[model samples]
Target chain A: MGLAVILCLITWFVLVNSRKMAPLPVSPTSAMVLVPPPTLTPLPTPTIYVSPTPTQRPGLPPASGGIQVGGYVQITGTSGAGLRLRSGAGLEFDPKFLGMDSEVFEVKEGPVEANGITWWYLVAPYDESRSGWAASNYLQIVTTQP
Target chain B: MDIRPAEITANRANSIVTIQWNDGHRSAYPFGLLRAACPCASCRGGHENMSAEPDAEVFSTVLPESPATRIRSVEAAGSYAIIIEWEDGHHYGIYNWHYLRALCPCEECRSRFGEAV
Candidate 1:
């Protein structure tokens, strides 16, 4: 009888525990609600980045080149974009006068050597005009100093 | 280094300023040019945008006559710069010798000192 009673009690305990609706005990540190595992998103990464010109060569290149001093010349290499007229020779000169396209100028003096590029000194062909230095690579010779 | 102006004459009627450099070069600037190339913090869009030379766009702009474009007076700011007072009560742009020389808009200066990219 005693053994039977013990078996019945053990069965009752198992049934009651299985039927319980309470959640598992949580510690204060783990009171946060359980979250599903997150899905990772991919990010884009660039493979190459090349600079158009060197950035470390401090200072500007001096004005250089332009044999047809005092001659008429046409602004070229504007490539549908405006050509920069610098205050001095070199790509890094300072404060541009304007970005003009196909503008004509009278060569003055130059053929200076700066930053491995040839430049020319030019004057405004007209009385109400501007004078400055420009890259020879962008200039097309129209005539000798006239 | 001898780029100092031997003489500076302001023609109020003509609204022009004639600067005769010691080297014998004469530059005549219109009052509009001065207003366009003003080096003041407000005129240049702020102090951080300030440069040793004028902006290339200054050549393309046509500033209309007004108190802002009218020169009230021109004062020497030491040997290096000149302080220009405008009739509009704005007198902040200080034109230094180096800056003034570089800002010359003549074709010679334009070609020789094209804006540094």
Candidate 2:
């Protein structure tokens, strides 16, 4: 039993003394050699975003290219109020019409005739319910053909 | 002022929507006010809270001139409602005639339905 106690005391003493021993001091240059050099990688360039300008479509006349169906057209030169959009082509149609100048419309279908005047079918760019025929003379094409 | 509009016109430059009723009552609403008064459940918070009237607070909620409030189109939904499309392609709200009538911000309607009648 005493031999066993001696073995345990020797083991504890060896462990505690070994733990208390200080680590060998290394030079600063040798400690730095253990560290990895930092890599200076280039950062990714940020992309610039450009927002598109709102196109005031369906109003202005084409500069050079001729206007086509599915393009935009504006109401212009209507004395005081604006151009009349009719259920069909002709003055015989209703005269009471909503006229907002500079408003644009999609050319739905047309090149039809009535009462000696040419009319173009239009779908109101703002109000689809206002789709009707407007006399071609009042139309001014705005954007490129769509 | 609880009448259907005989003619509806919007002045984009002025950001105003003028509605002339059959009874000669004219209501000119600011686009910002109307946008806030959108009757969709999303605008009203939830479908359960959706009612026949626009919220009184909507009259004071004026949105800016971004696509969120920019009017792209005004489409009639049959004889009862109007669906307005904004520049951002949001066209869900359907403003019915009765709702619009009740939403009138005129002096007459204000007395009829309080602050934002």
Candidate 3:
């Protein structure tokens, strides 16, 4: 019986020492607690830019002409018919419209010249009752047509 | 009272666009006061109420700086307003007939009121 007790004590001693000598089994909870080292990521940079080329567009060329009328003066013939000469374009006077026998003023069908100034003229008959040029500044050229 | 030609020139430059008058005077005007006094739908009221006053802030903001807008050319629209072209290539402002006619700076508006008064 004494030998058996000594053997049991020796076995306990061996078991305790063997536990200290062998590697400890890691716990599941403890294993999960380990933290990994942080990873480094590169950030993207923004770039600024300017345009080096000019944009092109298609269209008609700009207008490059200049023409304007100066002034107007009423013309009277000596016949006492009270006829007034008027310009439809402000550049020429109406010579054919100077008398009562003339027809309604129509711009002379073609370019006409008077008093050394060249322009397109018109001819209209003078109504004896209407004493002066009906309208002086009403005449103007339409410039945008061509 | 004495008449200052510089003042006349300045006032004439300030207002009185398209100086075509019955007495045979012709000149181009600026967009400053004219823009302020625009009688169109946007500036003035509309066609129905032609006499409504324009907003003061709009007028103050729109006055062109001096040296004033250089008039490239002027074209007549009937017996009333004129279409004007500016040196800056803006050709949209069409001045009305009554406005141009009323800008006569003779003894009437000048001596009676003040310049552009």
Q: Which prediction has the highest TM-score against the true structure?
A: 1
What is the alpha-carbon interface RMSD for each candidate? 21.7, 16.8, 23.7
Model 3 segments more than 4 A misplaced: A1-146, B1-20, B23-31, B48-62, B66-70, B86-93, B105-107, B110-117
**C-alpha DockQ of every model:** 0.02, 0.02, 0.03
**Candidate 1 lDDT, tens digit per residue, A1-146?**
99999999999999999899688876889757879989866422212111222233211122333246655555545542446677888878884565343345667778777888787877654433466778877765433432
Model 3 lDDT per residue over A1-146, tens place: 99999999999999999888968787767746767878955322212121221123111222421112221112212222323344343334453343221112223333334444334333321123322232322222211112
Clashes of each: 37, 4, 3
Chain B TM-score, all predictions listed: 0.93, 0.91, 0.44
Q: Predicted candidate 2: what Cα RMSD to the true structure?
A: 20.4
What candidate 1 gets wrong by more than 4 Å, as runs, is A1-146, B115-117
Model 1 per-residue lDDT tens digits across residues B1-117: 557776776655445566777676656565667788999999999999999988877755556556776677787776667888888999989998778777665445566667432
> Among all windows of ten consecutive residues in candidate 3 chain A, which has the lowest summed lDDT?
A45-54
Candidate 2 DockQ, CA atoms: 0.02
Q: Share of real contacts kept by model 1?
A: 0.00
List of clashing residue pairs for candidate 3 = A105-A123, A105-A124, B80-B97
Candidate 2 residues lying further than 4 Å off, grouped into runs, are A1-146
As a whole number from 0 to 100, the lDDT of residue B10 in candidate 3 is: 17
